[model samples]
Target: MKKTAYQKELAIKATQKREGTDNNKRDVMKIQSWLTLFSMRNPDSGTATGIDGDFGPATERAVKNFQSFNSLTKTGIVDQELFDKLSSNLKEAFEKPLVGNNLRSLMIEVAENHLKQHPFELEIQGQSNSGPWVRSYMDGHDGSPWFWCMGFAQTILDQASSAIDKNFKALMPLTYSCDTVGNTGLEKGLLSRYQKIRRDPSLLKQGDIFLIQKSRLDWTHTGVIIAVEGDVIETVEGNTNHQGSRNGVAVMKRTRSLRRSKIDVFSIEPLV
Candidate 1:
């Protein structure tokens, strides 16, 4: 997709906003945001250090305390797992439309929230004696009976819709098979499906589905489109790796510059 001049300018501005912030300021805001969301998810966990947006001594102490309690590395830096957990809680809280905030920021927040809530075991394939390459986040449960990337993608969409009280039934579902040899293999059938959706713009909206083909020519990843700025589509995806780790969502420009097998789009409709 070709980016318009205005879109390019917006992208540049977005990048600059992120990069212009001082590292300390950025980390402080991030930590505060994480703590706020965490508190929402686990009220029993106690109140957050507050959204001071400054990584001062108090914030550092609080992070260390959290890490110690969670039995995570007490380095005081918010790692991926901690970040994801916090994000999940925040997403549940802000599941509705945010009235006064930047859309890009909200999209990032929603993506992080969805990633934190999505369990990793759900990405694994069929019955196996041992777990898949990824660690299971679900407590006391063995690996899931089966794994479906499309279902995982749908879960994000459902959660996003619920947060905003929006009717997501308008978007249609794109089914995929877990079996490696089946017609649903990521590259074979998934790519074709995405192409079909992209070719038809009328079907797509703010939160549609897009399947990106990773290595091995299969539809190895799935994401929900949060915002479309000209040619670039901001997305949230799951199961890009064998590890059940929620690859924190990203906002990459839709350009040929990035190397990938193919991109599939699915226009979902509201359920009648």
Candidate 2:
């Protein structure tokens, strides 16, 4: 019997080291492992060019060809998108059901906890902009002014992941850009894509992240779906006050028509 991705024990953790343009060991290892498994998805996807832990020409060509076939830009760079695309099945194969509270419920708890503090917009004040609650996702600028909607979401996951047993980080990329998260879903199978998943809001559960698709290449804003009523979606968003802007002024909860928003939904399976 072949050793499964689960047996490898590495298929669960999201690759943290993304050296986009650097020739590093972690990137090489991640790409090699993904291509080794995902190449088997289709003959043209790419052959297992040996897991020698090298991001050489063979791996680059394989990635580019895979991207071209998948309708992604043939950048030939093994970025987050490429890694997620190649590991969709592998990720699914290793995904275990949440032992207790699902990631959604736990994430909501974290979000609500922050709401308790009534964190508001500070515009230029680094203190309020970089509150202690949302500081974990601030990268290095813990107490500095910065846009924080992404940080809010990621921070929720950070706290929730520790509380529950879900692979929140794996399912949701720990990034500040909603578009990048949406793109990763395209291949990693996070998107509630019509083909693989029903596009019905009725199917959307609480704790799901939705992106406001501004264009083919960009997602302007994001929020956590707290509830869904028919075509209306209630969300908890950060960095905004009212009249939703990409750069909102504070954290607020709001509801809107899903159709008007042109939203893209992403989810992970095995939620308890």
Best candidate (score: lDDT)? 2
- Reference-based lDDT, each prediction: 0.41, 0.59
Top candidate (TM-score) = 2
Overall local distance difference test of candidate 1: 0.41
Model 2 lDDT per residue over 1-272, tens place: 11121233232233322234456664475566565445544666664565555667777777777778788887767655556666554333223233437667766665666554354432123244532223334553433446677766665565566666455566656677887788887778667743222356666768777777777657777777778787787888887668987666556788867666777777745443
Query: Residue-wise lDDT of candidate 1 within 1-272, one digit each (tens)?
Result: 01111111111111111223533443454456455444544565542664444566666666766666676776655544565444443334234344423322433455556455433222223432112111111111223432344544544444445445544334433333322322333333322344444555343444455655543345455556666654456565544443322232221222221123255554433321
Evaluate candidate 2 by giving its C-alpha RMSD to the native, one decimal: 19.1
- How well does candidate 2 score on lDDT at residue 126? 25
TM-score of 1: 0.37
Native-referenced Cα lDDT, model 2: 0.59
> Model 1: runs farther than 4 Å from truth?
1-112, 115-148, 161-204, 213-218, 229-231, 241-260
